[model samples]
Target: MTAPTLFSPLKFGAFELPHRVVMAPMTRSRTAQPGNVPTALMANYYAQRASAGLIISEATQISPQGQGYSFTPGIHSAEQVAGWQGVTRAVHAAGGRIVLQLWHVGRMSHPVFQQGHAPVAPSAIAPNAKVWIVGEDGLGGMVECPVPRALTLPEIQAIVDDYRRAAERAAAAGFDGVEIHAANGYLIDSFLRSGSNRRTDIYGGSIEKRLRFFYEVVDAVIGVVGPDRVGVRVSPHITQRGMDCPDMVATTLLAARRLSEKGVAYLHFAEADWEDAPLVPEAFRRDVRHAFGGAIGVAGGYTLDRAQAVIQGGWADWVAFGRPFIANPDLPERLRQQVPLATPDTSTLFGGDARGYTDYPRTA
Candidate 1:
C-alpha cells in the first residue's frame, strides 16, 4: 500500500483536515497594550494563513497572573474574549480550524510583568532563562528571570481552575479546540520536571507527584472542553531554559500513556530546531507511538522532505511549521508548488506592525 503523504486528508478531533501541514503556535507579542487584547491587526494576520489544515493560535495567558511577557494576549477578561472572538470568526469565515494555546510562564518571567511580585513556580527556583519585556521607550529587550516563589497548594489549585476557566473562555470565543501549553519550561513543564521541581510535598518528589499539577490542569481543562477537543504540547528533549532533566523522556512517556487513557485528541512534541541541538531519538519516537495511540504531531526545523519522511515512517500524523508560516501565509501551497519561501525579518518577529506580521507576500 502507498504511504500517506503530507497532503493526505485525515480526521483530527472535530475537524476534517484537508492536509497534514499544521501552523505551530507562535508568540508575536503584538496584542493591544494596556489590556493585552487581541487587535484587528492580529486577526488579519491569522486570517491570511487560514489555508493550513490547522492553525494553533499563539500562546495566550489565562489570567493577569499568567502574563509573563509584555503584550501577549489574555483570555481571562471579557474584552480579551471579545477580541479573540473576532480572530476566530475571521479564521472560520475563511474555512479554517484554529485552537488557542493556553499558557502560564512560571519562572520564565520578570517582576516588571508580575506587578512587582515574583513569578510563581513548582519550587522557589529561578530559571536560567530570560523573557522579553518592553520598556516605556517602546523597545523590547530580554530580561533575566529571577527566583520565583513556590506555589502553595491553594494557589496551585487556583491555577488549575484558571486553566478550566481559560478553556471555557476559548470555547466561548469560538475556538475549534484548545492546546495545553505544557512545554518550553512553562508552569506545567516546571511541575513535570525534577530539575525545576524540588518540592517534597504531594506536588513533587517522585514522577507521580511531579505530574500531579500537570494532570490536574489537564483534567480541569478537559472538564470544560471534552477530551476530543484537547491537545497537549510537550517538549521532553528541549532542555534549554533550566529544563535539563534526565528523567524528562521517561516522564513524557508516562504522560503519553496516561493521556492515551484519557483519550485526548492529540499529543504534540516540540523538538529543538537549532542547528547544534541534539536530534530527537528515534527510539523515543517509537516508544511514544506505542504509549499514545492518539494522533501525534511534531514541530521543529522541518523541511518538506523531512516532514514527508516522518509521516511516511509512521512517527507523526502531522508536521507543524513555525517560521515558515510567519513569512509564507500560504505555506502548504508554497510547499505544494515547490516555490521558494520568503525569509522573515528577525528584527520584526517579536513586537512589530504589519511590516513583517501581515505584509509578507505570496507568490503571484
Candidate 2:
C-alpha cells in the first residue's frame, strides 16, 4: 500500500479537493472599518491563495456582542453578508472553496468591543488574556481582558439562536460551509472546559454538561446548514488564556464522538503553535480518529514533511497551514515543488493594508 502524501486528493464532505493543503483561518484585521465588513481587498487576498484544498476564513463574529478584536469581520448584518458575497465570488472565480468560521470570543473580550458592557461567559471569570485593539492613534496593541458577567439562561438560548442565524447568513453570503470556532479559549471553548465553565446548571459541571453549550451551538448550526456543511474546530492541549482544563482531551474526544454521530463534514484541531506549547499527543489523535469517522484536519507549525507524515500515519486527512499561507499565497504549489517558503512580516500582521496581506510575491 502506498502512503498518502500532502499532495493527495481528499473528498471532504461536499467538496472534492484537489489536494490536502488547507488554508487555516487567520485574523489579518484588515476589514473595512465602521462596520467591520469584508472588503474587496480581502476578497483579493483570498483569491490569491485559491489553490488550497479549502480556505477556512478568519474568525468572523456572529453578532456585535461576539466581536473581540478590532477590524475583524462579522456575519450578522445584511451589509456584512453582501460584503462577504464579493469575497466568496472572488474565491469561486479563482476556483477555490471557502468557508466562514463562526466565532464568539466570550470572556476573552474587552469592554471596548462590547459597547462598555461586560463580556458574557458561561461563568463570571476573566480569561486572563489580551485582545488586540487599535487605539485612537490607529496603533493596535494587546489589552487585558476584564472579568466578565455570566450569561443568563435566556441569553444562553439566545446565543444558540445566534449560531443558527449566523449560519443562515453565511449561506446567503455564498460560503460553501461554516466552521464553528469552538477553539482557542473563545466562547464555545470556554464552555467546553471544566476550568473555565464553573456553571452548576445543565450547561456545566460534568463532562456531558460542560459539552451542552457546545452541542447546542453545533446543533443549531447544523440545523441551518445541515451536518455535511458543518465542521468544528477544537483545541484540547492549548492551555493559554486561562483555559487550563484538566479534562480537555477527554472532553474533546466526547465532543468528537457526538459530532461524528451527527455526521459533521470534518473536525479540525487547532494545535497550539507556540515554541513552548505542549504537543498534541499521538495517543489523543488516535482517540479522535477512532471517535470521528469523518475527515480530520490539523493546523499548527506543520511543515511539508510533518504534514505528509501525519497524513500517511492516518491521523489526519489534511493539513492546514497558517502563517506560511500569509507569506506564500501559492503555498501548496511551493510545497509541491519543494521551494523555500517566505517569512511574513510580524509588524504588518495585525492591522495593516496590502503590504503583508496580499502583496506577497508568488514564485509560481
Candidate 3:
C-alpha cells in the first residue's frame, strides 16, 4: 500500500495525524439561539467530517464583549461550554482531533452587538466593513461598522484575560487544542495591519507595537494550554472587508516569526478564496517556511493536485479544505479515492437549520 497522494501522516504537536487534510475554520451561524451555543446538530455536523487530520471549529466568540454576529457560538458562558462539550465528544468519538478558533471582532462589529457602546479595538478606526445582524424586522441584514473606540491600557488587559479564560473553557470542554482567529480583519488582524490600526500608544505605531495585542493574547493562551497546543491563523493576502494593506505581507511574516518564537504548534494562513483573488507569492511562502520552524497549514481554493504539490515538496505540512468539506462529509476519503466533490448549497450556508448543515450524505 503505497502512501496516498495527500493522505500522508503528519505530526501536529503531540498528536500524530493519519493524513494531512484539515477542515479550515468557517462560520456557518447554526448555533442555538437566545444565548449563542453549540447544539447536537453541530455535533453531528462535525462528526460526519471527522476524516480530516484536524478540524478547526467555526469562529467562536470568547465573551459577550467578543461577539459581533448573530447565531455564532461562544465559549464564555456555562451553557456555551456545556454546548461545545457535546460537539467535542462527538468528534472524539469518531476518532478525530478538533480545535476551537477563538474570535473577537473589533471594528467589524455594529453597536447593536456591542451593547450600545462602540466596539473596542487597538485604535479608533472604522473598518468600513459591514457585519451580519438581526434587525427589528427579525431578519438578518448587513449593517455598516462603526468607528471603534480605542481600547485603554486597562481594557487591553481585560481582553487578554478574556482570551485566557476562553482557552481554559475550551480545555474544560475537551477540545484537543485551540486556534486564535487572528485573520480576516478581526481584532488581532486589525492590530497587525496598519490600515486598520492607527494608534500612537504602546499598542501601535510600529510593527512591534502593532503586534503587541496578538503577542499578549498568544502568551495568555499559551499560559492556559501551553504553546504546543496552540495555533495562529493569519490572512496576509486577503482583500476582503477593507483589510488589505501595503504592509500586510511584511507584518504577517513578522508576526509568524514571533509566533514561532512563542513555540506555537502551527501557523495557518488563510489564502484568498475569492474569484480572481491575489495569489500567495512563492517568495512569501518560502520566507514563512524558513522563518517558522513549525507546521504550516494553507487553505483557500485549493484542489487535490495543488495540495499534493505543496505538501510533497515541503512547502506546507497540510492543506485545509473549507467549502468542500461543507457538502462532502467524507472529503478526505473522496479526495484520496479521486471522487468528484459535492457542490455546496450557498443559500443554506448561514443562519439555517440542518438542511445544509448536517444533512449531507456520506459517500461509499
For each of the candidates, the C-alpha root-mean-square deviation to the true structure, in angstroms, is 0.8, 0.9, 1.7
Poorest stretch of ten by lDDT in candidate 1 = 8-17
Q: Give the per-residue lDDT of model 3 (tens digit) for 286-310.
A: 9999889789999999999999988
Ranked candidates (lDDT, high to low):
1, 2, 3
TM-score between candidate 3 and the true structure: 0.96
Please list all clashing residue pairs in model 2, or write none if there are none. Answer: none
Best by lDDT: 1
Query: Whole-model Cα lDDT per candidate?
Result: 0.93, 0.93, 0.89
**Backbone clash count, each prediction separately:** 0, 0, 0
- Alpha-carbon runs more than 4 Å astray in model 3: 1-5
Ranking by TM-score: 1, 2, 3
For 1-364, candidate 1 gives per-residue lDDT tens digits of 8899999998966667999999999999889878999999999999999999999999999988888888999999999999999999999999999999999998888888788999999899899999899898999898899999999999999999999999999999999999999999999999999999999999999999999999999999999989989999999999898899989998999999999999899999999999998998899999999999789999999999999999999999999999999999999999999999989998899987888899998779
